[model samples]
Target: MSGGFFRGTSADQDTRFSNKQAKLLKTQKFAPELEHLVDMTKVKMDVMRPWIANRVTELIGLEDEVLINFIYGLLDGKDVNGKEVQISLTGFMEKNTGKFMKELWTLLLSAQKNSSGVPQQFLDAKEEETRKKKEESDRIADEIRRTRDKESRELEQEKLKKMLASAIIWVHVLYLKTAVGRRCK
Candidate 1:
């Protein structure tokens, strides 16, 4: 049974994966559907190609569950129209979004299960994924802090400007009053 599974043909699996890829493309609001580009030559995968290649590379190297978690993190990290994309696999499942994450889960699990010789690069990718997650979290925290600090500074500056303006106006009024009195005397 195991041997039969192994010989089930990569072509067939590729076709199945392709179908899911098409569906994924249609669902993407802003991102490019990356899975569909697998059949293309390496030269064709240019900068214009979306992060799907990176995602798949990461997926194939890590644990199935970890890969899913990482993908969810990526989806969440994306600020589409300045709003975070929070549709994780669990969130999608809970909300009954569609077959999007379901297919993604299948792909990851299958990739892990079918591999006879897992590459050392996969281990490296796992480390990178962890590092990236930490970096992203730290970056977000820094951004929030920076925004708050900037707002605080701006508020202080505005208050100082108002006080200076008020002082100048008071001084001008006092000068005018003294000048009028002297003229009358």
Candidate 2:
């Protein structure tokens, strides 16, 4: 009746057997498998490290050590749940190298498109020249307007002077005729 009919052993023996079973269980957990996985990952990383470093240096413009440090920092970063998980930089690189290269090319293409390759000083000089040309055009327009206004005023003054002189002559002639008529009478 005792626990599957193995009641031949005494309570002390059973206790010893239980203790040994517990020890075996504790030792047989996933530790060995986890260690093997870690070793395999390390070997893979060793194989890929140089290639990854070269790509990062050539495409991303980072030194090998700097890139390694950055990758390690990212792998050590915490999740949104505030839990830290281990990551493999080599595995990440293996999976994303093509994507990284595509992004790098896109960035270079955009930069080439946006940049005219002109020196900053030359650009500034060109802008200043344009401003000066505009100012010169404005000055010439203003001067023309002033000259036209002056000519118009002078023409108006000449017309008034001629009208005044004719009126004075007419008045003098009329006075002479009235004087002669009175003398005759």
Candidate 3:
């Protein structure tokens, strides 16, 4: 569909509205009646509900009541028809998992990059995880270093034992060769 009806404030490729919403929306400056305003700020979250809806359906299991609660939470407690959300609002996300994950990452990254009010708790948690991982890696490195001398000593002893055994075998062969030569003479 060329999407002749239901204009948007932005020059975005997509209209960012459902078919019903598009019909209700005013395409031109002159509107016969007052209609619902398109909150461009929420365009991201509004699109997210349907985008990931199908992939998450399996996660919800057999609970119908859970869908309502889930939808409510998904909409941030916005008063919306649960049936509309269930039927048409979900599954707006890209179906390919890898692409979907990357898209979601970009979406979140854009939000964080653009916003000044990024939560301090998120930054704190990220720093904590990095510190813990670095400590674990350092502990392992120290343990390996501590055992290096002991391991090297044992390895050197093993090499000496193999060399001694080889020398004994060569001596026995030489002795047998001389004995066989004397018997022939």
User: Which has the better lDDT: candidate 2, or candidate 3?
Assistant: 3
Ranking by lDDT: 3, 2, 1
| Model 2 lDDT per residue over 65-138, tens place | 86666643442322210011112233435444445534432332332233452334345677999999999999
**By lDDT, is 1 or 2 better?**
2
Model 3 clash tally, residue pairs: 6
- Model 1 earns a TM-score of 0.33
Q: What would you estimate as the lDDT of candidate 1?
A: 0.48
Q: Give stretches of model 1 more than 4 Å off.
A: 1-126
The best candidate by lDDT is 3
Q: Report how far off residue 175 is in candidate 3 (Å).
A: 24
Tens-digit per-residue lDDT, 73-111, candidate 3: 644532332223333323532233234333433433443
Ranked by TM-score from best down, the candidates are 2, 1, 3
Candidate 2 stretches greater than 4 Å from native: 1-120
lDDT for 102 (candidate 2): 41
lDDT of 1 by residue, 77-185 (tens): 2122111222333342333223343433333333333343222344457789999999999999999999999999999999999999999999999999999989999
Sliding window of 10 residues with minimal summed lDDT for model 1: 77-86
